[model samples]
Structure formats: structure tokens, C-alpha cells
Target: MEHREPGYVADKAQLLKRLRRAEGQVRGLQRMVEDDVYCIDVLTQVSAATKALETVALQLLDDHLAHCVAEASAEGGPVAEEKLREASAAIARLVRS
Candidate 1:
């Protein structure tokens, strides 16, 4: 079954654009390594890319909580608890990262 909710649909375009830019940054990092650019500079770019990805993750988490989890909570049952647990685990993983 296809789970097609509007999770993050509103930020879809902006998210894609950010992800593409992050992709380009990763490519640039590869090139920098191949060209033997300064280690610090490359690390700086890596940090930028990492932050970009983190931002995407955060936005996704927010959307999930606002849409899926909220809906599930309103329903009030095992599914709601499952959704809350899922969100908590996701947030934990993000925090660890």
C-alpha cells in the first residue's frame, strides 16, 4: 500500500531545492578532495552540507509531528501511540546525530 499523506508537501519544492544545493556541495567536496584543497576548507564545506541535511531532517520531523502525529493523536488509539513512539524515536536519532 502506498502511504500518501501530505507530510511536508508544503515545503516540498523548497526542500528539493535545498537538497539539490546540498548535492552540489557534496560534489564540490569530492572535487576538493581530488584536487587536494586545504583540509580545513573541505571540512568547512562538509559542515555546511551536514547542517543543510540536518535542516531538512528537522523540517521533515516538524511536518510529521504537525500532520501525521497530530491526526493520529486526535484519533486516540494504539495507532496514535505508535505514531508518537515513532516520532520520539526519530527525534532521538536526530539528536544523536
Candidate 2:
């Protein structure tokens, strides 16, 4: 990977916070399942966790495209092209998911 200035440094803390919340949600879902909570309720928690994960993944993808790709392009050469390719592949995976 090309070394460049951070794109989403400012949002790092917030991202961590969101991840922690997702972790808690996962734990909550586990507890709900263990407690034999209603089936719909457990499914609801699963949906929430999935959505939260998707949200975070989107944010990271956006940052990678905007900051990392931009920086790599500015630097120019094979490295930038590689980064672009990697980002494209990642996006494809995300879309499939």
C-alpha cells in the first residue's frame, strides 16, 4: 500500500465507538438467544447488527476512495493503479454482500 496522509483520521474515534456499539449489539443478540428470547426479537437484533456493519463498511470504503485513492493517484505510477484496483475489488465484494 502507498503511504499517504490519513484520510479518515478525524473519524477514527467515532468509528471505534460505532464498532463498540456493534460489538455490544452482538453480545446482546447472544444473550437474547441464550435466554431463548422470542424468535423475531433475535432476528431483529441480527438485522440491526448486519445494518450497523454495512454502515461502517460503507464509511470505510468512502474514505478509501476519497483519500487513499486520491493520494495514490497524485503520486502516480503502478502504486496508484494497484490501489485503485484493490479499491474496485473491495467495492465489488461489498456490493455482492
Candidate 3:
């Protein structure tokens, strides 16, 4: 199969920015643990980091549905079925997380 640009290509920069911020949050979390910061404070930061990642995930999922899945569906064949299944699995994983 030919390689295609990801559905998130247009928003790649924004995605990277969010990911970097999340990375920082994680690093901060590590520092907090090492410094013996209050437990509640660490948990709050953890929630924030999780929320940031969830936002990124939702954006990517929307892009996939709008671009990859939509394009495959238009073609209407095994590719479309595969995309649909892949998307469903992704959604399930996100929900479980």
C-alpha cells in the first residue's frame, strides 16, 4: 500500500506542542515525587497531564475519522472495512484508558 500523509499532518505542529507540554508535566511529576511533594499535589498534576493527553487523543481521532476513514469509506471496499474496524478499536482503547 502507498504511504499517505496522516490525518493529523495539518495539525502536526500543534500536536507536538501539546505533547511537549505533556512531557514537561511528566518530568515535573518525577521531580515532585523525588522531592517528596504532597501526595494530593502530585495527583492533581497527574490529572492535568492525563487531560492534556486525552485532548490530543481526541483531536487525532477526529482527524482520522474525518480524513482517513472518510476517504476509505468513499472508496467502499475492504480498505473501508479495515479503517472502520481500526477506528472502533482506537475508540475502545481511548475509552478504556
Candidate 4:
């Protein structure tokens, strides 16, 4: 059977909003570069954009853990273990980034 990722479906609107905002920030960054903006100012904007994206990632992770992982854990056995492992791997990748 196929499993649905609840977080994405549940937070679909909010997630899309966040992603769109980040995409706008990226476009602004490109404009700044094209306009020959100061290095430090551009760097600051880049940092802000990165943080915004990271916040979205963290929020999604929290939702996944609370909804997906929690439900899977309650189910028990292989599926539960797989979900936990997937979450752990996601966390590791996030931390490394």
C-alpha cells in the first residue's frame, strides 16, 4: 500500500507560501547582484533567505515528526521503524547542511 505524508498535505498552503516567499528572496538576490549591490548587504540578504528556507524545513520536519512519525510509531513494527529511520536521516541531512 502507498503511504501519504500528512505534513505536506496538511500544511500545503502554508508551505507553498513559505516557498514562494523564499523564491522571491532569491530573485531579489539575483537583482541585487545585477545592480552591483554591496557585497556585505547582498551577503546579509542571502543569510536572511537561507534562514527563511531553513525555518520552513524545520517546520516541515516538526510537522512530519508530530503527524507522520507519531502515527507510524503508534502503528508499531517495520513501518514504524522505517519512518523513524527516514526521519533520522532527514535530520542528519538538515544538520549537515
Candidate 5:
């Protein structure tokens, strides 16, 4: 896989921790399915995983705007504006999803 930027990598570490927890939740869900556990319990686990992912996405987006976009803008010219546009589009797409 490609390397993450330093700031992003820091956020990614936290996200990865959350993902691992979510992974455990998925395994629990799988066991629930296998053991004929309640349907609502499994659904609740799924919802938790989705929310965890969304939280990670929002954290990364906030960091990108605060650091990368800010740095690019400070340097002047089109790069900063382009980065902001890209980040905005990405955020929009994420929200729509």
C-alpha cells in the first residue's frame, strides 16, 4: 500500500485502532449469525461499524483541511485552492454516501 502523509498517518493510527475494534464487532456479529442470535443484535453491530468508519472519515477530513490545505494556501498560487477544491469535493462525496 501507499504511504500516508505524516499528519494523516497519525490520524490513521487512531482510525486503525477503531477499525480493529470494529473488526472484532464484525466477528461477534458473525458468531451471532452462526449461533442464531437475535437479528436486532447483529444489525446493531453493523450500525456501529458504519458509524465508526464515518467517524474516522470525518477526523481525516478535518485534519486535511487544517493542515494540508492550510499549508498549500500559505505557499500561494493555485495549489492551495486546488487542494481545497479537491477536499471539498471529497467531503461532499463522503456525505452523499
Candidate 6:
């Protein structure tokens, strides 16, 4: 198989930034728990962190659909089928999460 740059390569820096922010949010959540912060406040932070990660996931999915899937689809063979299946599985996982 040919190795290609990932769909997210173009936005790698931005993606990393978002991931770091999410990481910080998680750390904050840990601090909140350790400090015995209010339950609702902790929950709110959890929601924010979840949303941040979701946004990143959605962007990644969009990029994969636009680049990897599109390229594979144009080839129209087993690779295309595999990409589609992989994408479907990813979407299902995201939805379940």
C-alpha cells in the first residue's frame, strides 16, 4: 500500500492546539475533583471538554471524507470499499461515544 499524508496534515497544528486545550480541560477537571469543587461545576467542565473533543472528531471525519475517502472512491475498487467501511466504523464509534 502507498503511504500518503493524513487528511489532517494540513491542519495538524490547529488540531494539536485543540487537543492541548482539551488536555488542559481534563487536567482542570482533575484539579476540581481533588479540590472538592461543586459537582455541577465539574460536570459543566466535563461537558465543555467533551464538546471540544467532539469538535475535533467532527473536523477529522470531515477531512477524511473529503480527502482519503474521496481519493479511494475515485479509484473504485477494494480499497474504496475498505475506506468506506473504515469510515462507517469510525462514525459508529463516534456516535456511540
Ranking, TM-score, top scorer first: 3, 6, 1, 4, 2, 5
Whole-model lDDT, candidate 6? 0.97
lDDT minimum window of 10 residues, candidate 1 = 1-10
Clashes of 1: 0
Candidate 1 C-alpha lDDT tens digits along 1-97: 2376668999999999999999999999999999999999999999999999999999999999999899889989998899999999999999998
Clashing residue pairs, candidate 4? none
lDDT tens per residue, model 5, 29-84: 88989999888888988898788878878888888888788877898788877888
What global local distance difference test value does model 2 have? 0.89
lDDT of 6 by residue, 46-92 (tens): 99999999999999999999999999999999999999999999999
RMSD of 3: 0.5
Q: Output candidate 6 Cα RMSD.
A: 0.6
The count of backbone overlaps in candidate 2 is 0
TM-score of each: 0.94, 0.89, 0.98, 0.92, 0.78, 0.98
Worst 10 residues of 6 by lDDT: 1-10
Tens digit of lDDT per residue, candidate 4, span 1-73? Answer: 3868576687889988999999999999999999999999999999999998998999899999999899889
- In candidate 3, position 48 carries an lDDT of 100
Arranged by lDDT with the best first, the candidates are 3, 6, 1, 4, 2, 5
Error of 2 at 16 (Å): 0.5
In model 4, which runs have C-alpha deviations exceeding 4 angstroms?
Answer: none
Cα deviation of 11, candidate 6, in Å: 1.0
Better of 4 and 5 by lDDT: 4
Location of the lowest summed lDDT over 10 successive residues in candidate 3: 1-10
- What lDDT would each prediction earn against the true structure? 0.94, 0.89, 0.98, 0.92, 0.81, 0.97
